[model samples]
Target: MSILTIHPKDEAQETALKTILDGFAVRYEIEPDETEYLMSSKANEIALDKSIKQAEEGDVVKIALDDLWK
Candidate 1:
């Protein structure tokens, strides 16, 4: 089985999507946004906090602006 990730454009679309899923009797699961998803795990939250702190301390590497596509 394959999983599908959907982002509803607005409340109306979200409601419509739910209605369609229900009508088709398709099973679906709702997931939290990225930040909340990561925070769901203690280890993930700790790692994210460390990464943020390091960035604030300028501990990240500097990359060339023109090399983004490379």
Candidate 2:
């Protein structure tokens, strides 16, 4: 079993692909659209990289659970 990510070029293609998969009874899941968050631009990736670097450098600030709502 392997995971595959398919980015259909348009809605028509997406519908056609899903129909074919349904006809074959292949188990698959349609992930929630993340175009806005994940692929809208490169900002998300840059932010993620920055966070990773901060974590690696131990530059994160820790807060207690009790202080979270404060």
Candidate 3:
């Protein structure tokens, strides 16, 4: 289970990416949650401090489709 952070600004792009992911013919799930640690991380931190400030600290869960096939 890998955690992938989707920046709020690239939401549209993320959605598009998800669409592409769906084409992979794999079973996956998206769970929405919230967290504060993202507020202090630099990994894939595509938003600015001021923008992150307004980030309601949330998460979108993605499970590997390969696991479901097993």
Candidate 4:
């Protein structure tokens, strides 16, 4: 058996796909969002936590708006 993972653009698309699948009696499972994958592992969770803490403490430097691309 093969499985297909889908990333819908918006809620409407997600609902439409679910509706189609349901109409066809296909079994499907809903998983967590992208953020869940970001912190899926312990090391990743720690790194994200540290980054969030730094941002909350205002330890980040601000770059000029025009210099963003350069």
Using TM-score as the measure, which candidate wins? 4
- Give the range where candidate 3 is weakest over 10 consecutive residues by summed lDDT: 31-40
Better of 2 and 4 by lDDT: 4
Model 3, span 3-61: residue lDDT tens: 56555457788688688778986455665544455545675354655456665454434
User: Which residue pairs in candidate 1 have backbone atoms (N, alpha carbon, C) closer than 3 angstroms, thus clashing?
Assistant: none
Candidate 3 Cα errors over 4 Å, as ranges: 1-9, 35-70
Q: Over the stretch 15-69, how does candidate 1's per-residue lDDT look in tens digits?
A: 9999999999999998788899989989999999999999999999988999977
Query: Measured by TM-score, how close is model 4 to the native structure?
Result: 0.58
Ranking by TM-score: 4, 1, 2, 3
Between prediction 1 and prediction 2, which has the larger TM-score? 1
Candidate 3 structure lDDT: 0.61
TM-score of 1: 0.55
lDDT values, one for every candidate: 0.94, 0.86, 0.61, 0.96
Residues 1-70, candidate 4: write the lDDT tens digits: 9999999999999999999999999999999888899889999999999999999999998999999999
Per lDDT, the best of the predicted structures is 4
lDDT of 3 at 17: 69
Minimal lDDT window, size 10, model 4: 31-40
lDDT of 3 at 21: 70
